[model samples]
Target: MLTLICQGSSFALHKMATGLRKGAKLNYKLMNEQGISLDTKDNSDNNDDQVAEDTRKDSVFSPVKSKAQKSNASSAEDDGKHSLPEEVDSDDQEIEKLQRELETLEKDEAKLKKIKQKEELRQKVVRKRDEVKALRDVRRVCIMGDSIIKHLPSIQGVSIFAFPGATIGKLSFLVDSRAVPLADFNFVIIHVGTNNIANGHSLQHMSSDFANLVASIRKFNKDIAIIVSSILPRPVDHSHTKSTVQQFNFHSQDYLASELNFKFIRSYRPFCFRGDIKRFLFAKRDGGLHLNSEGSNRLRFFFLRVISTLT
Candidate 1:
């Protein structure tokens, strides 16, 4: 009985050992199928974590990439901020250059205009000088005035240019227009200012007009003998007119005193008897504004005597 019991115990121990080995094998197979090995799972988990970390780093607003991109963006922004003003400054400099060029052009144009005007005036002066030098006749006389000198008898060498209601201004225009015809005469008698005195022109203005008229005549013929006839006396009742005429004549005589070949004749004195006008010397038909036949004859003789002296 003791031998049998020992054999059974050994068999039992052997079966138990076989069962433990089978259980270990089953566990190994389950581990292989379910992928539950520690080393392999740990390695796979590490790789997945690294991949997730890489994905998070590459995300749209990730801080790591955001910082680096922001740094790059900030550098670009700084460059733009610095360059913007430079572009604007360059544009402004270009505009300023254009403006300076335009101003220079305008100034040049103005200078050219002024130079052209000066040249034109110089040419006009030369032309007038040439016209004066071209005149040949010394005996031909021109008697130009208002209506007062219109009725003078025709003389051999005298040409009459009578303008009714003509003032000093009108005579200036007439002289300029008739410059060609007047160039023939060397003796010019200006019988004007009677109408100016009658029209009550200021003494200062009349004096200036007379000077301008004589200057105009001299421009046409510088060597011509110019005679400015005095304003004739009017009626005794016309006291203001007579006084103005006397003042005008006195001023003209003084003004023409230094002028070469210029004569201011006091023709009014011949018709005035001691500051009173001789009524017979003036036309009774026209309120003594004009001279009658006898007065005209006497004025012709007086002018003839002056002409003879010039010849």
Candidate 2:
């Protein structure tokens, strides 16, 4: 009786164990059918949560991302490809583009430097030409006037042409006759109006004669620099002589101021005291008209100073 009872209990325990095993198998199959993974630690709800978190991270950083990074991220999301190698390629392309731009900038800088060098060379050429022209202008000078200009000592580049009793009209005629020789010189000094004043020629007549004389010179050589020396004051022979001489010099200076390439030099200042002519500067033999040795030396000194400025 005890053995039968034990066998019945064993059968009942085996049936219970079998039912539990089948139930466990059924549960596993049902869970798999519902898309729940037992091997991995995630269910459908966890997967959805992880996907939402990843999407949030991408959206939060989208604005700050480079276009290349954003494109790589988009492709990664579309095709499941990794973005690291593509990012490296983008960096290399950017580096190459920057290098090309730098090369272009360097080329532009070199071209600008060459342009500056060319401009500097051109300026040097222009300056050299001007210097040569100035040198040529001071090379040969001709002093033409009455006997007063003849007393000037010989200079290397100077030529003297003097007529003892030359009036303004007489000098003008001589210049017209010798225009060819006068044209060869770069400068002409005229010192002849003393005779015009002494000969009692009216100031209007003298002025007209002087203007015609300059016109004749210019007709021969327009490039020549003409210097006109004022008449020297003589001892007061007549009260009007000194006043007339003063008027002639003032008119000459005023007229020549407007004339191109003409300069008027006052020659009476050194030989005159307060208002009268210095008696020592004139030779008594010529009735205080011609300059003596001391007077000639002083005149030469000032004349040479004027010539120095031109050179």
Candidate 3:
């Protein structure tokens, strides 16, 4: 009876060991499915507590996920390393485009400013030209001569510079001494050379002296209009005969009009009748060498006509 009971107890103990071994394997498989790792400890005393804590953490974390999700996450990280963010790239492009546009606007603004300046300058120049034209339209006139012109009536808007027995050679001296303000007048009517002819000057000498006098006056004002009056005919008893005076007048008028660009007035023709001096045209006290009031009035009418055209 004693042997039989001992054998029964041994069989029960073996069955319990087998059941425990199977339970351990089932727990291990469950842990592996949850992605939990179990480290086998050499110390058997804390092994149960360590395994239970690991199992609780794995259940809470739910660590085991799909392989496709993990692969997608890794691919996204790799793409991020190689490429820029869409919003960031777009912002950079927009900034660059704005900068380029600003640069273009600046260039256009600069060009517009330059164009505006040029237009303003052109307008200023045009205004200046107009002012100059208006100023030249109304000219100041001066009549300069010898004793013959000195006896004439005073004219309006005409400055007279007369010296008796004054030759063409002395005219420049008067101008240099500032006795004649050449700058004050635009039109100059000169009646000299008659005295120069009377003083025994040759035609060539008188012409040269007259030209020099005109040139000196022009030097004072380049734009001055010079009108040279012809020497009038004198009586036979005078220093110069009518023929000699006519010859001098012709040569002087031709040279003044053609070469020197001066306007020559033919005042001598009106005072002469058929190559002879008109006694009525001469001053009664001057031996028919100087003009009378009648002659001066007639010459004044001619001078008025000449002056009217200039303005």
Candidate 4:
């Protein structure tokens, strides 16, 4: 009986040991097959990224490159850049790609530079036109207002129909009867009413006076084209904070289209900051609100732009 019991115990222990061995082998197979590892970095086609970087480099180099391209090409060759590794070699094919990129950048830069140069040239032509034009047989342009344009110096062809302290109601030397043939002028620019606002002229009174001025000019020059440059922008300084000037401009702009020849020209975009003189329109010679040579040139260019559009 004792021997049989011991034999049973031995068999049970052996069975348990065999099961543990099988379990260890299964764990090893799973770990080996799955190969617990990670690929953390992304590897994608880098061609697009590299090409964009190359294009940017070309633009920066192309500015001075236009004059230097031939020299650089030769230098690059002598420096053995042509012998770079296959990955970055300046081989015939790669050199051709760089050349094409450089040309594209140079062309784009040239176009922008040309536009700026053209704007400057346009100013020169307009002034020449204004001078040559003043000497021509064109009708006179009589401006009536305060000092805004008082310093324009008498244009050769046109008579000085205005003076300092001229108000909305009456210009110092300007007579209503004289303005009858006004519409016959080649062009006209008017700026008035800052004084009126300061003088306590009500909106209604100012509007009425402006209407009279327009009517008088149209009556005189029946076929004259009106180029109404808005009131020169005023500075944002407290002394210039009056909104009535803007109100006057707004009202005039609204009424300007009523006449066939009346065309409102915004004079400040090129020289003034937006429409506010305080921010940008400092080109006036006085170093105040008015325009100086730069401002005059800007205006001259503006006229050309309009003429180009109309003709």
Residue 173 C-alpha lDDT in model 2? 90
Model 1 weakest 10-residue run by lDDT = 255-264
Find the 10 residues in a row with the least total lDDT in model 2: 57-66
lDDT by residue (3-107, candidate 3, tens digit) is 899999998999999999999999999999999877656455488788876666556476764466678888999898767677688999999999999999999
Which of the two, 1 or 4, has more lDDT?
1
Clashing pairs in 3: none
Q: Order the candidate numbers by lDDT, best to worst.
A: 1, 2, 3, 4
Report the candidate with higher TM-score, 1 versus 3: 3
Cα-based TM-score, every candidate: 0.54, 0.55, 0.55, 0.43
- List candidate 3 stretches off by more than 4 Å: 1-136, 236-240
Q: In candidate 1, what are the lDDT values of residues 1-311, reduced to their tens digit?
A: 99999999999999999999999889988998998774778899999999998789878767766467779999999999999999999999999999999999999999999999999999999998887665553478889998888888877778888898999877988887863366777788888887888788999888778778877887887878788888787773367786788777887888654553478777766687877777897898888878888888878888887778876
What is the total number of backbone clashes in candidate 4?
A: 14
Compute the lDDT for candidate 4.
0.61
Question: Candidate 2 clashing pairs?
Answer: none
Q: Model 4, 78-166: lDDT tens per residue?
A: 67764566546448678899999999999999999999999999999999999987665444554445665655544444443445667
Which predicted model would earn the best TM-score? 3
Per-residue error for 134 in candidate 4, Å, reads 16
- The C-alpha lDDT values of all candidates are 0.82, 0.81, 0.81, 0.61
lDDT of 3: 0.81
